[model samples]
Target: MFSSALSVLALASLCAGVLAQTYTIFFDNKCGRGTPTLVDQNGAVLSTGGAYNFNGSIIGASAFLQTGSCGPSGENCCTLKINDDGAGPECTKSVGTNNCPAEKCSASGGNLVIIFCD
Candidate 1:
């Protein structure tokens, strides 16, 4: 009985780990004097370097390349944006009064690389 219970526990642990999703954000800054930053909606800094790693999915998060008036978590910037919603991750572009339709992500899960000035 004890051996059976231990086997069950071990199986549960393995299943839990398998169910958990992992995500990595890589910032490729191909420009001058720019720092990459990722942030959430509640004004929390995720990463401020070349790469960031976390478990599970992210929603309403923002990424910014340190430059004029770009706030932490990527607020107040005129550029392309990506966010993961219920459907999936999306790529959006906002310019003036004309905003383009968001592009959906087909990626299952893995590393996300954001390149700046490239």
Candidate 2:
């Protein structure tokens, strides 16, 4: 009975790890300037690093390089938003980020790359 219980506990822990969800953020600051910023739904700062790792699903997140023109949450600028909920980048060639049209990315696939001036 004790052996059976131990085995069950071990299996449960392994399953928990396997079922965990995670994502990664990579900052490709090809512009060679400014700090990278990431913020949550409520405009809370998450990271200002080369990369960030997230656990579980992200919601209403935004990321951009702080070139002194954008907000802490990458707000107050163009609609170049990014989301964990499978949205894509804002703006088309005709619309332009300078006058963004609204869009974003995904978190389920587990990778988010934020580029600057490239």
Candidate 3:
């Protein structure tokens, strides 16, 4: 019985690891008028524009664009939310001039491009 319980625990651990998925998020800022800041689910700054590897459990990820110098002092900003969906990767802007619609992921993990305009 003791050995059987240990085997079950080991199998469960392996299954849990297999079920945990990781995604590579690419944030592209095409906004000509501002500097973008990427924020994760916990409001931690991820990156400006590049790549970030995130666990599948992240939620409420967003990106903000500062129209001035691209920092805390910048004014007139816009917020874009990153949606977690199995259908594809999606991004939606709450405010600002969006040049393109939300991008979709090509696979389970893909890039999300945010384009802003004046």
Candidate 4:
């Protein structure tokens, strides 16, 4: 009986993990230079926050940052704060402009595509 109960408990844990979801912000450098920062609905930096890796010259660099959130779908749209890295403020759409579309920040697949538009 104890063994059976233990097995059930383990199964439940596994299922929970499988149901867990995460989100990734796809940053674009269409304009010039900028980085996307993830913030919660309350205007706070997400607990699990990090920057994306940039490649090529600074003029045309591009990358994406990722953040993890186990919250519900509708309650998980993060505020993508766009910061134009000295390339003219508001030249991007991910940070300065609060117009980046929100999508399910999925664990398996990436959500929302952000870009720096000049």
lDDT of 2: 0.60
Which of 2 and 3 is ahead in lDDT?
A: 2
| Clash counts for the predictions, in order | 0, 5, 1, 5
Q: By lDDT, who's the top model here?
A: 1
Compared with the true structure, what per-residue lDDT tens digits does model 1 show for residues 5-116? 9999999999999987666767667666567776676778777865666676677676666665665555566444557543334445546622212212233446566666
Model 3: per-residue lDDT, tens digit, 13-79? Answer: 9998887666666645554544566777676788766676665544677766655544342223446
Candidate 1 stretches with Cα past 4 Å from truth are 85-90, 97-109
Q: Give the TM-score comparing model 4 with the true structure, all chains together.
A: 0.42
TM-score sort, best first: 1, 2, 3, 4
Show the colliding residue pairs in model 4.
28-114, 31-116, 31-118, 81-95, 82-95
lDDT of 2 by residue, 1-118 (tens): 9999999999999999988766687766666666767777788887885677766666666666676887666655543355554332221121235633222332334676655555
Best by the TM-score measure: 1
User: Considering TM-score, which of the candidate structures 1 and 3 is the better prediction for this target?
Assistant: 1
Candidate 3 achieves a global lDDT of 0.58
Query: What is the lDDT of every predicted structure here?
Result: 0.61, 0.60, 0.58, 0.37
RMSD of each: 4.6, 5.0, 4.6, 14.2
TM-score of 2: 0.67
lDDT ranking, high to low: 1, 2, 3, 4
lDDT (10s digit) by residue, model 4, range 25-113: 45444433333444433444432224432221122222223333312211242343333333321213234423334422211222334
TM-score for each predicted model, relative to the true structure:
0.70, 0.67, 0.62, 0.42
